[model samples]
Target: MKSLSLIVLLSMVFSCNTSAQKKDDQLQNKTAFKVTKTDAEWKAQLTDDQYQVLRKAATERPFSSPLNNNHSKGTYVCAACKTPLYKSEHKFDSGTGWPSFDRVIEGNVAFSTDTTIGYMRNEEHCATCGGHLGHVFDDGPRATTGKRHCINGDALEFVPAKS
Candidate 1:
């Protein structure tokens, strides 16, 4: 009888977790972004690295992106759709390997909850193309927005500000 009760409790816990996960997945997929592309179109347009990170939500190796060391005056645009996502002035070094920004360009980025790693994280993506940029965190420069927009450099293309 005790064994049966244990099994029942385990089943109930698992079912509740599965249902919650399903709801979260549905919420993530319900948004209609401004730009939509077929998978083949995206594959053809983006390099394998870009496709993996932007379309498949894969993370690039830490400190691997040249953009991490870039200190230029330009707008960081979405690699897939050229949507201006972050401004140079807003960029900062968070020592997190990825390009960290204090804030996103208003109206150009979107946010959703990510639970892929068994925990909740604030995921940011391009509002235009729905490309996954990276996760955001609350621990950032207190002087600024106090939010860290940790971005995948592979998902961005820097456009230098004109002289």
Candidate 2:
């Protein structure tokens, strides 16, 4: 009887995990963004690094992006859709090797819960194209929004502000 109970408990746990995975997959696949393109089109338009980070949710190497050290007045836009996402004034040095921002351009960015790392994190994405930009955390400047938008530089394109 003890062995049978253990088997039933294991089965229940597995089933619950399977269902949670299915839900997560559905969230990823079912969203309809303002801009949608075929995989081939995305491949042709973006470099390998851009495609991987934006479309496949892959992270670029730390300190590898030129934008991480950039401190110019500009707006950061989505690389895939060119939608304005972050303003230069909100950008900050989070020391995490990625382009960090304290806030996003409202309505241009979106958030979703991410559990791929075996823990829940708030993931950010471009609202226009549903491209994975990066993740957000509560640890940020207290003087500001107190939110760290740790964005992937490869997912962004800087547009200099007009003089």
Candidate 3:
């Protein structure tokens, strides 16, 4: 019947649209936010683990980074471009095995749609180098910004504040 044919055509069109959307949902960062370096240069500059997490959008193991336990007063900068991202005052213990902060330095971090694990999440990136930092969540200190910037310690380097 003509009605059945119309239904089949509509289904095909919708299916194609869905497939295209899925393909576009990948968390790959193709746009360079600021710092742009060759792959070889990045490999030469960063450690193996740091390269993996920052460039490949991978997460480090829980409790693997010493920064998680660091309580020193200092600023945390991006591993790739050394852009100041978070302060020691915003750091807190979320028991998530990563360096967590109440908020990020405004406009110093970028966000993108991440669907690598088949679920959509707002993935954080270094505004300077476009490196993967981590995800931000709404569950955080009620007294502060109430936003949790769960960052990978390997993606950050701490600089102790001078007395």
Candidate 4:
């Protein structure tokens, strides 16, 4: 019957998609990271909040981090891997309660599609460790990349410039 044939074809298509997704996940897991560590090690290295956000891709409460209001000349590095990610000049208050940057240090950040929030958004991660930093959106200052690197402050550690 046509109905039976259609059902079988649909099942095969979905099965192939699932298999492909699994393969992609395996490939990502094997990606060479400069700062690789076990879950236990990472937990030990990072604070509770940092572990939750960097290791588990959790978001911090908005307007909670003092980093959001900080305007000093400095560099923001990954709290987990200490990789320089965003410069203070790139940071802007998007009024979104999170620190928003118009750009990042090239080659220091990687992006992948994140569907954890029930929608697909470009999730930024530390290139060295694959630790979750935050999401990048298209809404940003048009003078630059027109991209907003909406980052979680807990995922970053600011290093101020010497006077």
Q: What C-alpha lDDT values do all the predictions have? A: 0.90, 0.90, 0.88, 0.89
Q: Clashing residue pairs, candidate 4?
A: none
Clashing pairs in 1: none
Ranking by lDDT: 2, 1, 4, 3
**Error at 14, model 1, angstroms:** 10
Give candidate 1 misplaced runs (Cα > 4 Å).
Answer: 1-31
Model 4 residue 104 CA deviation (Å) reads 1.3
Candidate 3, residue 48: the lDDT equals: 95
For candidate 4, what's the RMSD?
2.5
- Global CA lDDT computed for model 2: 0.90
Task: Compute each candidate's TM-score over C-alphas.
Answer: 0.84, 0.85, 0.84, 0.88
What TM-score quantifies how close candidate 2 is to the native fold? 0.85
Instruction: Output the better candidate (3/4) by lDDT.
Output: 4
lDDT tens digits, residues 22-123, model 4?
534632573667878999999889999999989888999999999999999999999988899999999998999999999999999977777876998888
- For model 4 the local lDDT of residue 163 reads 89
Clashes of each: 0, 0, 0, 0
The lDDT leader among the candidates is 2
Question: Model 3, clash count?
Answer: 0
Candidate number with greatest TM-score: 4
